[model samples]
Target chain A: MNETLAGWLQILALVGALALSFRPLGDYLAHVLTCPRHWRVERLVYRVGGVRGDADQPWPAYLRGLLAFSAVSVLFLYAFQRLQNHLLLSVGTKPVAPDLAFNTAASFVTNTNWQSYSGESAMGHLVQMAGLAVQNFVSAAVGIAVVAALIRGFTRKKTDRVGNFWVDLTRIVLRVLLPISFVMAIVLVAGGTIQNFHGIQSITTIAGDHQSITGGPVASQEAIKELGTNGGGFYNANSTHPFENPNPFTNWLEIYLLLVIGFSLPRTFGRMVGDNRQGYAIVAVMGLVWAASVAIVTANELHSVSSSAGHAAGGMMEGKEQRFGIWASALFAVSTTLTSCGAVNSFHDSYTPGGGGMTIFNMMLGEIAPGGTGSGLYGILILAIVTVFVAGLMVGRTPEYLGKKLGAREMKFASLYILTTPGLVLVGAGLAMALPGERAAMLNSGQHGFSEVLYAFTSAANNNGSAFAGLSANTAWYNTALGLVMILGRFLPMVFVLALSGSLARQQPVPVTAGTLPTHRPQFVGLLTGVLLIVVGLTYFPALALGPLAEGLR
Target chain B: MAGSLTRLLRHHLAALRMLLVFTVITGIAYPLVVTGIAQAVFPHQANGSLVKDGGGPVASSLIGQRFNLPSQKGQPSGSPDPKWFQPRPSAAGPAGYDPKSSGASNLGPNNAGLVKAVRDRRTAVAAFDRVPPSSVPPDALTASGSGLDPDISPAYAYEQVNRVAKARSLDPAAVRKLVAEHVQGRTLGFLGQGRVNVIVLNHDLAALKRR
Candidate 1:
C-alpha cells in the first residue's frame, strides 16, 4: 500500500503541474479560436493561408477546413515517416519497412502508438527523435485544439465559424502541452531516465556471460508520449523495461505522466467555459470512474490464481517488472487504458481475468475515462449532452446544454460519434473470429484467445495502441484490418464531432431560466454517468461477454 | 443589442490577444524546454531507455529477456537458464518465445490436443525434475499467451532449484535462498502474489558458483 500511496503522490504532483500549465494554454486557445479576427499575429497567419479573418464560416466550410488540415497532416506525417530512412542515411541509417511506415503514420495521427516494429532496431536516432517524437506532441495537440474549437462552438451565442485550426493547434502545442512535458521530462531525467545517442554496448553479466545493452535518447520522447497520451514506447518493452522505468520512483513518474495531462484537461475546459465547477464535475465523474476501474483491475491482477493450482497462489506477477510490483503495474495499466495513452509497465495478457476485463471495459467506454486530448474532451461533451437530454426527458422539458437545446440533429451527431467505434470494433472482431486466417493467428484459444481478438479491436477502435503483446497481429490480415479500423475509428467520430460543433455553433444561446437544469448539479452528474454507462454497455455487452467476462468464468 | 455585443466582443478580443501571445510561448516554448532538458540530462534514457554492453547495444532493458539454448558443457549460460527456469513455454515455433513474434498457443483447455500437450508437458517436467506430476505447476506445463514472460511462480522456480543445484554441485539451501532473494512480493504488499524472477536468479546462481 505504501508503494501505491507513493505512486499516487507522484502522480498527484505531475497532475498538479499539468493543471497549472493547462490554464494559460487553454485560455489562450479559447481566446484565439473565439476571436481570431482581432489578433495581429493570427491575422498574418490567416492572410498567408488565404483565409478571410472576418468571414464566419458555416458548417460546410468548417468541415472542409477540418478535413483539409487532417488530410494534410496525415499525408505529411506519412511522407515524413517514409522519407525518414533516406533522410537518416546521411547520418548512416536505413529506412523502416513499408508496412511499419503505414502502421507508424496511422499510429501517431490517430493518437495510437501501436508499433509493429521495434524502435531501437527499426528506427534511427534521427527519425525516433525528430519524426516520431515530434508527431507524438503535435498529434495530441491537434486533439486538444479540436476539442477547444468544439467548446467554442458550444459557447458561442450566434457564430457560424468553429475556430481557426492553425491557431488552435499552435496554442495547444506551444502553451499547454509543451511546457508541462518539458518540466516532467526534466524530472524524469533526474529520476534516471536516459537521454543520449551512444551506440549499444556489450557487458559481461554477473553470470560471467556476455550480454548486450541498448541505449538512446528516450526521456524527451517518453515525456510527451505519456503526457500527450500517446502510447508508443522508445523500446519494445515499453514501461516494462528496467532501463525505461528503472526503479519504483521512475515507474510512478511514467504512470503519472501518462495520466496528468489527460486528467487535468477537464479542469482546463471548465476554466475556459468560465465555470470551474463544470470542470470539477467532469473531473469528479471521470476520476471516480477511472479510480474504480483501477481498483478492480489492481485487486484482480494482484490476487488471481492460475488454473494450475500450484501457480495461482501468488498474485499476478507474470510478465511484470518486479521493481514496480503488481499494484503499480496494475494502476498504470488501468490508467493508460482509461486514457488513450498506451504506455504499459506490464503485459496486459498476463493480467488477471478481471484486470484484463476492466482494461477492455475502459477502452469500450470510447476511451472517455478521461480519453485522448481532443477526442476525450469531445467524447465527454457528447456524454454531457446525452445527460441533459435524458434529464430533460425525465422532467418533461426539452434538454439544453450551455443554453443550446438538445435537438434531433445534435443527438444524431452525438449518437453516431458515440456508436461508430463500437460498430467498427465489433464488426472487425466478428470478421476476425469468422475468418480462418484471422482465427489461425490466435496464440491462445477459448476465453484468453477470445481476449486477443477483443483486445485488438478495442485497442484499434479506441485508438489506444497498447496490445496484449500475446497476439500475432503483425500478420497481413490483422495489419490491414486493424489499420482500417484505426483510420475509420478515429476520423468517423472526428467528422461527426465537427458536424456537431457546426450545428451547435449556429444555435442561438438561450438564457438560463428556473426550468434549466444546471449541468454541474449532482442530479445532472448522475444522469451523465448513467448515460455514459448505458451507451457503452448497450454497445459492448455482447462483445464483453464473448471476450473477458466469459473468459473470467473459465 | 448588436452594438453592445460588438463592444463585448471587442473587449474579449483584447484578452484574446494576451491568450494567443501566452499560448505560443507556453505551448512551443515549454515542450522545447522539456525536450532539451531530457536530452541534456539523461542522454541514453532520453533517446530510449536502452542498455548496451561490451559489444555495443544488445537489447532494451524494458523488453523481455530471451534465453535460447543450454550452456555448452563448460560455458556459462548466464542467469535464468532455460534448463532450470521453467521456460516461458513458447508459442513461437522453432525459435521459442521470440519477442519480435510474441503470442500464445491459442489452444483452448478443452481441446483434446491441448489437454494432451499439457499432460505431455506435465510428464516431461516431472521426469526432468524427478518430481511427482501433481507437483508440477500449470505455468510450467502451459504456454503463456506472450512467450516473453520474465518471471515464474515461486513453485516453478523451486521445482527447478533442486535439479539445477545438483547439476551445479551447489547446496540446495543456498540456491533456495537465492531464489527467495529474487522473489518479489505483490505490488503494494497486497495487490499481487509473491513470485521469483527466473532470469535474475539463474544469473545470480552462475555468479555465485563462479566465485
Candidate 2:
C-alpha cells in the first residue's frame, strides 16, 4: 500500500475507534464527576485527606482547595526529588540538584511533564513510578476536576457553588483514570513493554561488550503518561522506545489514548449542558483543526518522497524512528501536540519545516483542538464564549450562551484567559533571548536557535511539555525560566476559567430567542474555528514566521 | 506567623497523606495488578521479550543493539559491523544505543549542524553499504527518535542483502530470501509501515558459518 494511503487508513481507524468510545466514555465521565455516591476507594481517599465527598463549596473555596493542593503537591515532589539518594530504590544516585528538582516538580504537578533529566539515568525506579506516575494520575485528575467545576458553572444558576474539588478529584482519579490506566497498562505489557522492578543490570552484547540494562515498571507508567496526557518517559526515548511502545499497534493505541479523554470531553460537556449536539459542535471545531494539522504535516513529510539524491535523500527524516516511517510519525506528531501530551514516537525537531510548524501551531492554538484531558473541553468552551462575544458585537446584541449572558465581567475573564498563555510565552521567550546566559543553552545558532527558545516557551506556557530538544534546557537558565512559565501558564488560565465559571453560575439562564446565536449550529462551529485560527494565528504569527515559517521557506 | 504556619502545616499534612496514599495506589497497587495480569497472560513478553538464542536467552528482538567491532584507542564504539543488518542510526546516548541513555539527536531540520551531519551520514552509510548514495534508504541515514529502534525500513533491509551475502559467503538470493521472510507487514492490516527486525535478521546471519 502507498504510505500516504496507510497513514489515512490509520487515521480513519483512529477516528473509528474514537467514535466508538466517545459517547460512552464522555457520558461515563459526566456520570463519574457528578455521581452522588462515592466508591469505596474514593471515600477512603477523601476520609484520609480529611475532606467530605458529599459536600459542595463555593467557587472561591473550590479555587482555594485547588491552590492548596497544588502548592502541597509541588513542595512534596520537590522534596521527593531532593531525597532520591536517600530513597531505597534510587540506584545509589545522589539527590537531584535544587533547580532541576523544583522545575520537575512544577512540571509534573502542572501536568506539563517537561522532563529535563533523562528518565533511566537520572531517576530511579521508585521516583519514576511513585513520584512521576503518581503525579500523572493526580495532576490529570486536577484538570478534570477544574473542567467539571466549570461545566457545573454553566449547568447551575443563582449559586456560587460549582462542585467540591475533593470529591471531583478523588472520583476522577479512582473511577476514571485509574481503572482505564490499569487496563491500558496490561495491554501495553502484553505488547512487550517491560513491567519488571529489576534495577540496572549489565548485559553482554553479541560483540561481548558490556551494556547496562535499565528496567522498571514501564508499562504502568506508559499507560497513564498517555491516558492522563502527561508525556514524561521512563527512558529518554519516550514512546519510541521498544519497551514503552514496541510495535505499530501500540503506537496507534498511544495516539488514541492521548486523544480519547480529551476529544470525548466535548461530549461530556454537551451531556452536562443538556445538549449532545452542543458537544458535537465543539468536537467538530476540534476535529477539523486537528485533521487539518495532520493532513498538512503528513503532506509536508511525504512531499520530499522516499528515495532521492544524497543530500536530497534528507526528505526530512532526521529524528524519526524508522519503524513508524514518515506517515505514522506525522500522525503521532500532530496528535501529541493537539493535546498537551508531549510524548513523541518520533522527534518533532527533525520534521520538515512545514511539519514542525504545524506542531508548533497546534500548541499555539492553546491545544484546544481537543486539548489536555479536562483542560481541552474547558479551553474550547472559553474560546467559544469569546467567539460568541465577538460575534455578538457584530450583531449588536448582548451575547448569551447556553442561556447565560456573556456580560462585560465574563468577557473580561475570557480575554484574560486567552491572553495569559501568550503573554507568559512571549515575555518568557523575550526575557530568555535577552539573557546572555540563555544563548549558551541553545545548541543551534541563528533562527533555529531562536526557534528553540520560542518552542520551549510555547511548550511550557501552553502546558505542553515537548521541547524542540535541540535546546540544551537542563540548565538553571532554561529550567527556572520555563518552570516559572509552566506554573503561571497552568494556574493563571485556570484561575480565569474558574472565576468566569463562578460568575456564570450566579446568572439565571436566559430563555432561548431568535437572536440567541444558536451555538450548536454548523455556522457557529465555523465561527468558532475561524475565531480560533485568527486569534492564535495573529497572536503568534510573527514569532512563528521567525522560527518554523522562516526555516520552511528557506 | 505561627497561626499561618499551622494552617500551612495542616495543608501540607493533607498533601503528604495524599501523596502517600496515591503512591501506594498508583506506584504499588496499580503496577502490581497490571504486572500480575500481564505476566499471567503473556509471561515471555511481560518479562521483556527476551528471545532465546542457542541455549540461553540473547537480547530482546524488539530492542536494537549495536553490532560493532571492539573500540579502538581514542574512539567511541557503535561502528556498524558489515556482517549484520544495521538498524537505524542511534543517537540515544554518549556512545549510542546505550539502553540506560535512550534519546534522539534532537536536531531540527534547518540547523546547519544537522544538514552537515545528514550529509556526512549519507556519504558514510552509502559507502559502507556499497550502494549508490541515492539508493540508500533515508532510515539508514537518520537517527531514530528512541535510539533503540529494533527494526529498519524494508528498503534499508533489502539494501543490506548483497553485503550480508558477500560477508557470509552465501548466495545473494538466499540472503534476500531470508530478508523477505523476516519482513513483517503492517499490524492488523494497516497501522504502521512494513519493516524488518534487524536483531532477528542478524541472529539468522550469525547462524551462517563465516566464509
Candidate 3:
C-alpha cells in the first residue's frame, strides 16, 4: 500500500478511537472529581496520610497542599536517585550526579520528563520503577486534580472552596490512572515491550559479535509514560527503542495513549459546566491546530526539501525507524509535541527544517492542541478567556463565559498565565546563546545550532520533554537551568490558574443576557484558534526566523 | 508568625506521609503486579525476546546487530563483512548499535557533517553492493531513530541478496527467496510500512548456510 494513504488511515483510526472515548472518559472524569463518596482504597489512603477527605479548602489552602506535596515529591525523588546504589534492583549502576539527579527529580515531578541522563546507562531498575514511575502516576494525577478544581470554579458560585485537594488527588490516581495503566501495561508486554528485573546481559550473535542488552520494568513504565503524557524513556533512544515501542502497532498505540486523556478533557469540561457545546468549541480549536501541525510536519518530511542531507539521501530518512517510516514518525512527532507528551518515535533534530520547526512551534503554542491531560483543558480554557476578552472589546459586550464574567481581575490572571511561559522560554534560550560555554554545546553548527538551544528552552518551559536531541544538554549549566525552568514553568502558571479559579468562584453568577457573546458557537472556535496562532506567532517569530527559517531558506 | 510556621511544617509532614503511602502503591505494588502477570503469561516476550543459536541465547530478534570483520589494530572499527547481511548504519553510541547507550546521530538534515556523511555513505554502499547510487534505498543510507533498529526496508534487504549469495557461494535465487519470506507487511494491513527484520533474517541465513 502507498505509505501516504496508510498514514492518513492511521490518523483517521486515532481520531476515531479518541472520538469514541471522549464522552464516556470525559463524563467518567467529571464523575470521579465530583462524586460524594470515596472508594475503600481511597479512604485507606486518606486515613494513612491523616487527610480529611470531606474537608473543602479555599484556593490558597488548596494551593499550599499541592505545593507542599510537589516539593516533598521533588526532594524524595532526588534522594532516591542520589542513593540508588544502595537501593534494591540497583543493577550495578552508580549513583547519579547531584545536578543531574536534581534535574531528573524536578523533571518527573513537574510531568515534563525531560531526560538529560540516559536511562539504561545512568539509572538503576529500582529508580526507574519506584522513583520515576511513581511520579509518572502522581504528577499526572496532580495535573488532572488542578483542572478539576478549575472546573469546580465554573460550577460553584459565591464560594471560596474549590474542592478537597487530597480527595481529588487520591481519587484520580486510584480510580483513573492506575487501572488504565495496568491494563495497558499488560497489553504492551503482550505486544513485546519487556517487563523484567534482569540486569544487562552479555550476548553473542550468530556471526560472533558481542553485545550487552538491558532489561528492566519497561512495559509498566511505558504504559503510564504515555498514558500520563510523561515522556521519560527507559532507554536513551526513548520511544524509538524497540523495547519501549517494539513495532508499528505499539508505536500507534503509544501516540493514542498520550493523546487520549488530553483530548477527553474538554468533554469533561463541557459536562461539568453544564454546557456540552462549550466543551465541543474548545476541543474544536485544539483539534484544528493539532491537525494543521500534523499535515505540515508530514508533508515536510515526505518532500525532503530545505535539508541538504535529505536532498542527498533522496528522502528524509535520518533518525527515523524503518518500520514506522516517515508517516508514522511524523504523526508521532506532531502528536507528542502538541500535547506535552514528548515521547519521540523519531528524532526531531534530523528532520527537514520545516518539519523540525513545526515540533518546536507546537510547544511554543503552549501545547494546548489537546495538550497534557488536565493541563490541555485548562490551557485552552485560559486562552478561551483571553479570546472572549478580545471579542468583548470589539463587540462592546460584557465578556462572560459560562455565566462567569471576565472582569479585570480574571483577565490579569489569564494574561499573566499566558505571558509567563514565553518569558521563561525566551530568556532561558537567550542566556544559553549569550554564554560561550553553553553556545559550544551545540552538536550542529550555524543556524541549525541556534535551534538546538531554542528547542531546549521551549520544551522545558512548556513541560513538553522532547528535544531536538542535537543539543548536548547534560552539563551542569543546562541541567540546573532547565530544572529551574521546568519547575517555574509548571508551577507558576498553576499559581495564576488556581488564583483565577478562586476569583471566579467568589463571583456570583451573572445572568446570560443579550450583551453576552455566545461562546458555544463555531465563531468562538475560529476566534479562539486565531488568537492562539497569532499570540504564539507574534511571541516566537523572531527566534524562529533566526533558527529554522534561516536554515531552511539557506 | 510562629503559628504560620507551625502550619507550614504540619503541611510538609502530611505531604511527606502521603508521598510515602502513594509511592508504595504505584511504585512497588503496580510494577510488581504487572511483572507477575507478564512473567506468568508471556514469559518469553516479557523477558526480552531472545533468539537462540545452538541452544544458547544469541541476539534479540527485535534488536539490530553489527555484521563486520574482526577489527585490526589500525582499523578499530572493522569493515562490513560481506559474508553476512549488514544492518543499517548506526549512530547509537561511540561506535554504533550499543544497546546500553542507545541514541541517534541527532544531526540536522542540513548540517555540513551530515550532508557529507550521506554523500559518502551513498557512494560506499553503492560500491559495496554493486548497485547504482540512485537505486540505494533511503533506509540503507540513513541512520535509524534507534540506532539499534532491527528492521530495514524490504527494498534494502532485497538489494543485499546478490552480494550475500555471492559471499556465501550460494544460489542468488535462494537468498532472494529468504529475503522475501522475511519481509513483514503492515500490521492488520494498514498501520505502519512494509519492512524486513534484519536480525531475524540473518539468523535464518546463518542456519541456511550451515545446512
Candidate 4:
C-alpha cells in the first residue's frame, strides 16, 4: 500500500476504534464513579483503610483526601528510590540521588512520569514494580476521583458533598484500571513484549561480541503506561524500545490505550450531564484539534525539504523508528502530547520545526484535547466553564453552564485553573533563563536552547512528561525546579477544580432559558475550542515565538 | 477543636493505609500475575526472544547488535566485517550498540550539532554503500529512535545487497532475492513500517553457502 494512504488508514483505524469505544467506555466510567454498591474486594479495602464505603466528602473533604493520599505517596516513592540499594532485585545498582529521587517521586505522584534517570539502569526491579507502577494506578485514579467530584457537583443539588473520595479512588483502581491493565498486559506479552523478573543478563552476540541484555517485567508497566496515560518507560528508549512495543499491532494498540480513557471521559461527562451530545460536542472539538495537529505534523515531516529526497524518500526519518515510519510516528507524537502520556515511539526533539511547534502547542492547549486519564475530562470541563463565561460576557448575561449558574466564586476558580500552568511555565522558564546555575543545562545554544527551557516548563507544569530530549535536565537545579513545577502544576489546578465543583453544587441549577447558549451545538464547540486556542496562544505566544516559532522561521 | 484534630489525624492514617493496601494489589499482584501468565504461555518470548544458531543461543532478535569484525592490531573496533548485512546507524551509547545503555542521541532538528553529525553520517554511509550522499535513505544516515533498533527499512536493506554479494562472491540476484524474501509487511494489515530484520535476514544469508 502507498505510505500516505497507509498512514491515513492508520489514523482512520485509530478514529474508528476510539469511536467504537466512546460511548461504552464513557458510560462504564460514569457507572464506576457513581454506582453505590461496592465489590467484596473494595469493601474489604475500605474496611482495612477504616473508611466507610457509603460516606461522602464535600469538595473540601474530597480535596483533603486527595492531598493526604498524595503526600504519603510522594514520601513512600521517595523512600523507595533512596533505599533501592538495600532492596532485593536492586540489579547491582546503588540508591538514587536525593534530588532525582524527589523529582521522580513528585513526577509519578503527579501522574507526570518525567524520568531523569534511565529506567533499566537507575531503577531496580522492585522499585519499578512497587513504587513507580503503583503510582500509575493511583495517580490516574486520583485524577478520576477529582473529576468524579466535579461531575457530582453537576449531578447533585442542595448538597455539600460531591462523592466519597476514598470510595471513588478504590473503585477506579479495582474496577477500572486493574482489570483492563491485567488483560492488556497479557495481550502485550502475547504480542512479543517481554515480561520477566531477571536482571541484566550478559550474552554473546553472533559476531563474537559481549553484550549485556536488560529485560524486566516490561509488559506489565507498558500496559498501565498507556492505559492510564502514564508514559514512564521500563526502558530508557520508552515505547520506541522494541521490548516495550514490539510490532505495529502493539504500537497501534498502545496508541489506542493512551487515548481510550481520555477521549471516553467526554461520554462520561455527557451521560452524567443528562445530555450525550454535550459529550459529543466536546469530543468533536478534541477530535478536530487532534486530527488537524496530526495532519499538520505528518505533512511537515513528509514535506521535509531538509534534504532533496526528503519528500520522495520518507520525511525526516531522523529520531524515528523505520518500523513506525513517518505517519505512525507523527500520529503517536500528536496523540501522546494531546493527552498527558509522554511515551514516544519516535523522538519529538528530532521532529521538524513545524512538527515540534504543533506538539508543544498541543501541550500548551493544556492537553485538554481529551487530556490525561481523569485529568482530561476535568480539564476540558473547566475550560467549558471558562468558555461559557466568555460567551456570556460577549452577550451581556450571566454565564450558566450545564444548567448551573457560573457565579463569581465559580469563575474565580475557573480563572485560576486556566491561568496556573502558563504562569508556572513562562515564569519558571524565564527564571531558568535568567539564573546562571539553571542555564548550564542547555545543551543546544541560542534559540534551540531557549526551546529546551520552555519545553521543560511547558512539559513539567502541564504534567506532559515527553521531553525535547535535548535538555540535560537531571541536574540539581533542573530537577528541583521541575519537581516543584510538577507538584504545583498538578495539585493547584486540582484544588480549583474541586472548589469550582463545590460552588456549582451549592447553586440551585437554573432551568434552560432561550437566552442560554446551547452548549451541545457546533457553535458552542467552536467557541470552546476558540477560547482554548486563544487563551493558550495569547499566553504562550511570545515564549513560543522565541523558541519553536523562531526556529521554524529560520 | 480537639475532636477536629483527632478527625484529621484519623483521615491521614486512613489515607496511608489505603495507599499501602492498594499498592500491594496494583504494584505487587498485577505485575506478578502478568509475569506468571507470560512465562507459562511464552517462556521464550518472556525471556527476550533469544534466537539460537545450531542449538546455542547467539543474540536477541529484538536488539540490534554491531556486525563488525573484531579489532585488528591497529584498526579501531567498529569496522564492518562485510560478510554480514549491516543494520541501521545507531547513536546508542559510547562506542555504539550498547544495549545496556540504549537511547537516542536526543538531538533536536534545529540544533547545529545534529546537522553537522547528520552531514558526517551521510558522507560516511554514502561512501560505504557506494552511492551518492543524496541517495542514502534518511534511516541510513540518521539514527533510529531506539538506538537498539533491530531492523532497517527495506530500502536501506536493498542498498547494501550488491556489496554483500560482491564481498562473498555470491550472485547479486540471490542476495537481492534474500532481501526481497525477508522484507516483512506491517502487521495485521497496518501499524509500523515495512521493515527488514537485519539479524534474521543475515542469519538466512549465513545459511546460504557462498559460490
List each candidate's DockQ score: 0.13, 0.60, 0.88, 0.66
Candidate 2 error regions (>4 Å): A305-311, B1-8, B54-57, B73-78, B209-211
Give one digit per residue, the lDDT tens place, for model 2 in B1-211. 9998998778767766776787889877888887788778877877778766666556778778888777788465567777778777788777778887788887766556666766777788888889888787778877888888888888889988888788768888888888999999888778888889988888777776544
lDDT of 3 by residue, A430-477 (tens): 999999999999999989999999999999999989999989999999
Candidate closest to the true structure, highest DockQ: 3
* lDDT to native, each model: 0.68, 0.85, 0.92, 0.87
DockQ, computed on Cα atoms, for candidate 1: 0.13
Q: Write the per-residue lDDT of candidate 2 for residues A1-554, one digit (tens) a residue.
A: 77667778999999999999999999999898777877787778877877666879898878888888888889888988899988878886678899999999999999999988888878887788888899999899999999999999999999999999888887888889998998888888888888887777666666555666667889999999999999988877888888899998899999999999998898899999999999999999999999999889888887742212214555656777766778788888998898999998888776777787788889999998789988888899999999999999999999989999999999999999999999998999898888888877887677767888898999999888997888889998788888999999999988999999999999999899988899989999999999999999899999998887877676
In order, the B-chain TM-scores come to: 0.66, 0.88, 0.96, 0.89
Which rank order by lDDT, best down to worst? 3, 4, 2, 1
lDDT of 1 by residue, A421-538 (tens): 8889889989999998888787677777788888988899889998876678877678777877888888788788888888888889888999999978777667778888988898
Residue-wise lDDT of candidate 4 within B1-211, one digit each (tens)?
9999998888888888998998899889889999999999988888889888886677888888888989678543787777788887787887677777778877767566667777777787777778777877778767888898889988888889988998889999999999999999987566778999998888788888777
Error of 1 at A185 (Å): 1.8
Off by over 4 Å in 1: A1-65, A89-94, A305-313, B1-70, B73-211
- On a 0 to 1 TM-score scale, where does candidate 3 land against the true structure? 0.99
lDDT for model 3, on a 0 to 1 scale?
0.92
- The worst-scoring run of ten residues by lDDT in candidate 3 chain A lies at A204-213
Residue pairs in steric clash, candidate 3? Answer: none
